[model samples]
Target: MSKGRILIRNGHVIDTEPQPVAHAHTDVLIEGGKITAVGRNLRSKGAMVIDATDRIVLPGFVDTHRHVWHSALRSAAIDIDLGAYFRLLGQVGPKFRPQDVRIATLAGALECLDAGITTQLDFAHIAYSPELANAAVDALKEAGLRAVFAYGTPVNVTAGGKLADVRRIRERLADDNALVTMAYAPLGPLSTPMETVARDWRIADELDLPLTIHLASSPNNEQPIFALREAGLLREKTLYVHANGIGDDELKLIADSGATASATPGDEAGRLRRAGITTGTGIDTVAFAPGDMFSTMRAAHLAGQIAEDPQLTAKDVLRMATLDGAAAMGLADRTGSLRPGKQADVILLRLDDLNMLTAERDPIGAVVTEAQPHNVDTVLVAGKVVKAGGRLVHADLRRTARALRATAAAISGR
Candidate 1:
């Protein structure tokens, strides 16, 4: 194995484990895509060293949910309700050519790296063709980010052809696991036929790959749960996204299936649009948000509180965003926490930041409530410096932003 040279020193390591608050200073040694050592007075020659004296080192955030294609549409449908937004996305989604997906995904992936998100579950639903899927995967790889490219089979494509095409694409792209993993992302029940969704799940199971689907995004999707139950397709391998409208029975089914759930509170709150609905109706669902883990933690904490369970701790919320999320995506063995032998995917949060300084005693509390994207000083994906001083090292932010603006304008026909 080849070793990469990099050293991070003089930082307060804030891993998931709870240690003494005052034990702050430490050195981290990174060699060949993994953390070789972490302690005081670590020595290494001919290695690049980063001064992290005032920063808080942590495991890089894992964003379990995001529509990367919607990066250009940030707040585009802010005034429109959910129904209208869906209609608009449905119309606009297919209009995007493969080039558009490449640009949008590249921009979104770069933004995530800049925001200190090391690993992301990019639910790419804009894959109207195999070329679009390949383009999105290529963009993620070029950005040097870890991602699971969930290849979405558009309803139109499935209706136009047979299931064999989906299988062929999965087979061709399943082995390329350098920085990107391929997963099956079937459009959820409301838009896609239940039979196709089940067929997709069967293929996913046969290939032993993680399967993701948008579920219970609205009240109308309740019937899909029953359909899944009838088909006996609800299983742990199935990762359900935005399952806000699920009930107790569905929760039991999920628990029995050993499946996992991801909830994006920020997007769910209609920050982008009214979206008609107020909150997802899922049961025992975990909270999630792309690009920002602090907000996701807070949202999970609040959701637990709303369920009359005020005893939920910040650590619990953090786990959902980190470890639980990795398990949900079936990548727990490789990443998730800061442990020996795990990939060195880590982030450094500035403790002195005003938002993070309030709770000095509880590091978890500081991370969940006080830390923001700006507090991120450094981010490492697979033991590489992707973000330093809160800026992307390999991304051209200004140009990407301009391109996204033009793409959005074109889509809106303005």
Candidate 2:
């Protein structure tokens, strides 16, 4: 609209950049997909103006780690623990055909957008074949979300792509500036041999792609971070997911290495933050946890209070969901905050909604503690209006629903 110029006017703007700040009755101007100005009474010729009155305009949420393809199996293992969840996925992962992966990934990405997650690092460990990997990436592009499609080994599958296939996928996703980029999601030191881990890290290093892997969420006592350090494979481009049950010493090592960590709400997120690690919020899986960042932030806050950690405040949790998460995924400079020259990945939440009606005094606290997905009134990615007036634009939800149901039924034999 208006030749790629949008001006959001008269909103309570919140920014989580160098630090968290709130500006009342502010305006934002976006031109050609980049934020040009954020202040009072901003003007742009031929700009399409959207009134953000009684709305919380802020940077969209970033999910540092998510198994997006598993959204097809949502709540399938909600009652199970990590070990049993893996066991169940062992059976379910192999049953996903290429088309099934496509539908699941598309639905998943749309779900993320609906919940105000403008960016996600998809830990797609379901690449059972080259075709499957392509299907997942294609679905991300189709859904139009900013994503990092981390190519990884499929679970419990023998005849599928291996570490070498990472190189193959890298060839296809070479453009780093695209909406959908690539990462390497290798089985880290805990699951693979030392030599295999070394090789995978080298491949990712050579490709200049970020590395993300699950670490320290299991009962095993192995020090995966330490192992990476001793092997000289630890790098800042690596994102360690679910660093639960890790000791303080290991957390210090993560901080010292300049590496980042992702913590799902139910995990040891508070501990990670208390240890001074740059922790970000992750939904982990829709199959087991809520997909919305509001719920994720609430859970993280409650967990911090339960642990008696004094460092966790509402602002802190909000930062974890926004700028910190972007930094964790190495995209902070491009899309995290409401700053000039950054991509316009932003959302507006209606403060008039019953769930958020009392957010006038402490908007950040209400956002973390009271807001829900239904309050999201508008969403934009790269200056494009993906959602407006509480509905997705150019989306065929009925069709997506039918395909999702058929795929889930086929996979479940129901």
Q: Clash number for every model?
A: 8, 0
Name the TM-score of candidate 1.
Answer: 0.85
The top-ranked prediction according to TM-score is 2
- List the candidate 1 regions with Cα displacement exceeding 4 Å: 1-3, 17-23, 155-165, 188-193, 217-223, 266-291, 357-360
What range of 10 consecutive residues in model 2 has the weakest lDDT sum? Answer: 155-164
Superposed by TM-score, candidate 1 places the C-alpha of residue 104 at a distance from the truth, in angstroms, of 0.9
For residues 169-188, write the lDDT of model 2, one tens digit per residue: 88889899899999888877
Structure candidate 2, residue pairs in collision: none
**Candidate 1 structure quality by residue, lDDT tens digits, 86-124:** 677777788887777888888878777776678888877
lDDT score for residue 385 of model 1: 81
